[model samples]
Target: MSNDDELKQLRERVQYLEDRAAILDCVMNQARGHDRHDADLMGSVYFEDGVDEHGPVIKTGPEYGDWANAAHESVFEDHLHNITTHTCEINGDEAHAESYVMGAMRIKGGKIVSLMGGRYLDRLERRDGVWKIALRRCTVEWMMSGDSSVLASGAVKGFIKGKWDRTDPSYTRPLLLDGEPVSRW
Candidate 1:
């Protein structure tokens, strides 16, 4: 191929990689925030009307946000979410992304602990020139015993110990219940 043609191809390849990386970053940030009990951060990654299915029932945007915040608060004292093996497909303004995630949590009591390994399947859309998640479904591929004390301690450590600062726009608000803010600590 001609030098100009090769350069053009290289540019296109670079653009594609950049786009993929951006989307991956968004998904990773959202997952990390959720694991770390950062509700606002998790909400920021989704569209206003996004759908989330973390449990048996699917939840709407507002419901998901509420549940996420509350659930994270009640869970562990600290958490670390590691994502890997991401596979993404882009078509026009829509895309699908999937990744494997392994998470560890430290509970409030030193004796209790919890861990979950899962796969996330996400649907994304380009909204107003930016890519945002429209739907996210988490499949818990595996989970360890849920120890209350260990979970609480881990959550406290995860949120209060500044682990949530690794990402921009952290979700630092208190968890809510029944539309009202509730204390999880």
Candidate 2:
């Protein structure tokens, strides 16, 4: 109706979108942090007293960081977390979200553990202009198990490049076209 009213409405809509984007960034940060074993980054996604339930075990933000990092290091030689769809319902300063996730791990016992599908349900709250997780519940829907060693049973000799930390090539290597033995992937 009035120009002033229209401008106010548009600003509110922009704020809503910005909030949604910030929340999604948190979601991705969790995935990347866990996979990279960056405990601090992972913990930053949550409030100081935030809680997370991996199955029936519930832990506070700091507790989860310690537990998850230890478990990943002891149980898996390597692991990757991939987040898919994310849907959030914003209610002013609070929101509820569910993020679909899949993960594959190279277990220490030579097993390949695959969580084919799962969901991270989150309760978020914004305080002091910052949105953070107040709670999270992870539910695994399906999984497949295999032998990790078999994947390299007949491997050729080479320096297969990868690292658990920021030293990974993804942090530095420039794009290049594929050559004879290098697939550029």
The numbered model that scores best in lDDT is 2
- Name the lDDT of candidate 1: 0.73
TM-score of each: 0.72, 0.83
Give each model's clash number. 23, 0
Model 1: what TM-score?
Answer: 0.72
> lDDT tens string, model 1, 73-124?
6765567788988999988789999989887766655455678899889999
lDDT of candidate 2 over 52-129, digit per residue (tens): 999878999767877898888987877888998899999999999999999988777655665567999999999999
Lowest lDDT block of 10, candidate 2: 176-185
Query: Each candidate: what lDDT?
Result: 0.73, 0.82
> Cα lDDT for residue 33, model 1?
67
Residue-level error in angstroms, candidate 2, position 133:
0.3
Which 10-residue window of candidate 1 scores lowest in summed lDDT? 164-173
